[model samples]
Target: QQQVKQSPQSLIVQKGGISIINCAYENTAFDYFPWYQQFPGKGPALLIAIRPDVSEKKEGRFTISFNKSAKQFSLHIMDSQPGDSATYFCAASKRTDYKLSFGAGTTVTVRA
Candidate 1:
């Protein structure tokens, strides 16, 4: 079984709109949750991350909402611009584990 699940394989948003992506995981051992964004040519880069201690986190236009009991998380982009369009992935890792399990990626497009 896949440890993590993601929804809406693809999304399209207008300029200055909000874009959202969701993720769910089955592993209770997971202690770290991170989101990654990737452009066409470059490698995926860490966008934002959250520990179960906090329910939510926000940085600039990016936000990560996490639910520990529910084993779920979500990413939201505010005022999404064309440059924000990219593939986003949600991942989970345990404190002692070196490997990270990633949910299927979501491809977002911001229309100019």
Candidate 2:
């Protein structure tokens, strides 16, 4: 399945709050995991990524918690802010081919 269903589909968060998004997939053949962040009319940027080999991965203010057995993953935004407002997408691919299977999209709005 090339589709990645992400929910709430959209989100609203206050400044300094935590924002969470979840995703699931059916392709066990996929191994690479990458979470992308996008602003209006812009290409998605890689926020964080992990492999099924690892249970979790984190960056500065971004975190990706993955569960291989469940074929699911989630993104956690710590101390969210207005600047963090954007769309997020969780993707899976085989290797470093640069080809990505994307979620519909998730829009996050952070208010002050």
Candidate 3:
């Protein structure tokens, strides 16, 4: 298992709303989990992440829920705003490898 897959390649959320997306993975060897947020053309920026050791991790408007046994994870956006609109990606890798295997990518739209 060496791949992570995400769905709803695009999403739409209203301001003050919540956006939820899901992802699945095949590799159980991954040791680190990271999420990236990207703008129109900029490189993905590290958002929030969670390791298998933890069930959930939250930071500001973002949260990551991890299900180690299922090899699944998810991202939740609270108080979604227009400014939150962007592309989100989920990735995983081992501590030895910095190269992140990312999902297909999800585009979120938060209307004002």
lDDT by residue for model 3 (1-112), tens:
4399898889998899999988899888897889999999799999998889999999998999999999999999999989899999999998789688999999999989
lDDT against the true structure, per candidate, is 0.94, 0.90, 0.91
Candidate 3 clashing pairs? none
The alpha-carbon root-mean-square deviation between model 3 and the true structure, to one decimal in Å, is: 1.4
Question: Can you give the TM-score per candidate against the true fold?
Answer: 0.97, 0.93, 0.95
> Where is model 3 more than 4 Å wrong at Cα?
none
Cα error, residue 9 of model 2, in Å, equals: 0.8
- On lDDT, the candidate that comes out on top is 1
Per-residue CA lDDT of model 2 for 80-109, tens digit only, reads 989999999998888956678988888999
lDDT of 2: 0.90
1 against 3, candidate with superior TM-score: 1
The superposed Cα distance between candidate 3 and the true structure at residue 83, in angstroms, equals 0.5
- Model 2 alpha-carbon drift over 4 Å, by segment: 96-98
Positional deviation of 6 in candidate 3, in angstroms? 0.4
Tens digit per residue, CA lDDT, model 1, 1-112: 7799998899999999999999999989899999999999999999999999999999999999998888899999999999999999999999789998998999999999
